[model samples]
Target: MAGTSTGVLMAELTTTARATRVIAAVVGVALLLAGTVWGQDDKFPFGPFSMYAGVNGPNEPAPDTRVEGTDSTGRVIVLAERNAGVRRAEIEGQEGAYVDDPSRLARIADSYQRLNPGAPPLVKVALIVREHEIHNSSATGRWWDDVRAVWDRPA
Candidate 1:
């Protein structure tokens, strides 16, 4: 009788241990999924330019400028100053305009030329982030990926 009881107790202990491990694993996976979902909702705030094309003064840097824009359909127009009398610009956008619009690139070039005609010629100007993340706490598992573009200038 004693031997049988001991064997039964040992079996129950093993079963309990397995159940605990499984529960832990499930909880870990659930937390991971929640974290990923939360991360996708994160947002970074951008800016408010004075003139669409002007000597816009410096602004705050946005968080994670390395990450590309989520609006893949929208275009990213970058104008950089290349040298004394030259500037470089590129427009990356969805496929429609490139095929249909003949004046788009020319318009951009003309705008830059008109804006900085006599000035140093915008030696280098590009679409860049000027803001950063503003977090209140250091707690782990907080999601952060959304981007908000505000028109108000930073103080």
Candidate 2:
């Protein structure tokens, strides 16, 4: 008798698990549809997959940007390495903000010098973004860089 009861319980548990999976799948499909039909402005809690279009194929140019700094002695340094833990994406997204108010860049420079006491004093900081063209995804092509932003310390 006990064996029979345990068997019934196991069957019920299996059925419940199947139902949960179906419900989860349905909910996922609904979210995908809503995200696509509504708008790409983050209607859902997460996102609509900004770059769902996939890569730029085998031949294209990708963006590569970083901050370069000039030390007090005229030595070049990568400001991104000592940017007070700010990532490249965050800074790039805030490009307009930085351009509007360059004082923020100054604060970041100060943070870099403070964190790396042994490093030389940073006098100028420039954000450079480069575009590198790729050929057949196997070889790199022509590349060009642009100076997006530049900041210097007070005399």
Candidate 3:
């Protein structure tokens, strides 16, 4: 009688576990479908990955944005994540805000100085967008820099 009761309890637990899994799977699928239909980049894991979903024309110039700083020593430094602790994607995502408010770029320079204490202080910071000339869906080894925003320290 004891052995039969134990077996029945195990079977019930297994059945419960299976039902829970099914419900979770159904909810996950529903969320994914809904996210795909109406989600933006901020929705992340459930949303359609917009970066991969985007398409560029074969002959369109591809934009590559970067932050550049002119230090006191008169050297132009490319402030990448390694140097400035700011990612290119982060800058690109807020391109418009930087354009609207150029002073915001001073924050990036401050970030760079904080990360590299020994380095020369940045006197000028500029947000540059380099458009690589594309032909037949490939780079043509030609590009132009568009200075979108500039932040100069008060000397």
Candidate 4:
């Protein structure tokens, strides 16, 4: 009798485990299908997180970017010259969202003001992006300069 009861309990446990696995698999399938069916920005399991996927996307050569400003005396002050605690990649990431916004330039100017207490105020600020053709890792040909965003604020 004891052996029979133990056997029955083991069978029950196996069935429960199988059922749980089946339910989980069903839910997983449902989620996968749902992701494929949803319209835009919802395809996660089967979609790319990048904006574009092609040779022109991320495979293109990376350009140099700078947050430059014209001081009150019309001198160009690059962010690196001020020794601001900022990185090029940080500005690169922000360029996507702040490229068309003027406040972003203003914010950079403010940061520069904080960094240089004795320097003259900035007359205009701009986020400049320069794209150069990839001609080896050391040297490149003439590139294009594009003013992605700018703000003119008088001190």
Candidate 5:
């Protein structure tokens, strides 16, 4: 009788495990389908596969974004990951938001100050975009900076 009960319990557990796996797989597939249909960069992981989905036309300029600051001594500083503790990709991803409200850049300035205590305090921060001139889908070694937004430190 004991042996029969143990065998029955094992069979029941196996059935439950199989059902759980099937349910999980179905949910995963549903999320993938939904994300593919209606996801953007913000909805990453399951989002649309769009990092390289779009192609640029030959002879069109390619945008390169960077963050820069004007210090108290009037020296320009590039705020890269090492100095500012923020990555360029993070800034580029939210370029539109910064353009809409330049004041948001103050956070970056604060971060820069926190990381580099001896450096001159930033007087101004700006989001600049350099469009690299391209020809035949190749870089022409020419570019121009377009200042999208500037945030001046308050007195």
Candidate 6:
């Protein structure tokens, strides 16, 4: 009778342990799904630079453009020009040194023209600079800057 009781108790304990493990696994999976969903959702604060679609320049004021959507890589993609518009433009960057390369700029301009046929060429392009900080275990801190371009078309 004693041996039987002990066996019964051990079985019950084993069952409980197995049940707990299963519950934990389920919870873990749920948390992982939640995290992925949250990451995919919009409304998250993106990078430092925000894109302006219509027209923004030195003398002119910024246009009232809404953020259409953000890509999976967190790049802000906006519809600067739509519906067979004349011009289109985009600016993308992360933390790094800021430089305005004419070759790259020309490519961007060409892309804009192609995307938005009949749109006026980009008259002005401005680069907004932002700073980022990185920390390392070697007790060293590094700071870098990045830039995003803002282009404007003649109205």
Tell me how far the alpha carbon of residue 98 in candidate 6 is from the true structure, in angstroms, after superposition: 5.4
Q: Lowest-lDDT window of 10 residues in candidate 4?
A: 48-57
Q: lDDT tens string, model 1, 1-155?
A: 22474465333447889899999999877766665555222211122221233332234222332112111224333444331222221222212342254333344344555755753222222223334433343323333443322111112
Of the pair 2 and 5, which is ahead by TM-score?
A: 5
Task: Return the TM-score for each candidate structure.
Answer: 0.20, 0.59, 0.75, 0.55, 0.71, 0.25
Q: Model 6, residue 59: what's the lDDT?
A: 40
lDDT of 6: 0.40
Clashing pairs in 4: none
Off by over 4 Å in 3: 1-13, 23-43, 46-48
What lDDT tens digits, residue by residue, belong to model 2 across residues 1-155? 22464465323447889899999999988887777767453354433544344577677777777877788889887766445555675566677787777667776687788888888888888777788888888547689987777889989
For residue 76, give model 3's deviation from the true position in Å: 1.6
lDDT over C-alpha atoms for residue 102 of model 1 = 32
Predicted candidate 6 versus true structure: per-residue lDDT over 1-155, tens digit per residue: 22474466323447889899999999877766665556322322321123332333334322222212222344344434462122322333221222444233434445555775766554443444333332332312343433354444334
Clashes of each: 18, 0, 0, 0, 0, 3
Ranking by TM-score: 3, 5, 2, 4, 6, 1
lDDT of 5 at 82: 97
In model 4, the runs with Cα more than 4 Å from the true position are 1-61, 135-140
Global lDDT for candidate 4?
0.70
lDDT of 4 at 7: 68
Q: Candidate 5: lDDT over CA atoms?
A: 0.89
* Segments in model 2 whose C-alpha atoms lie over 4 Å from true places: 1-60, 81-83, 135-139
Error of 2 at 54 (Å): 7.4
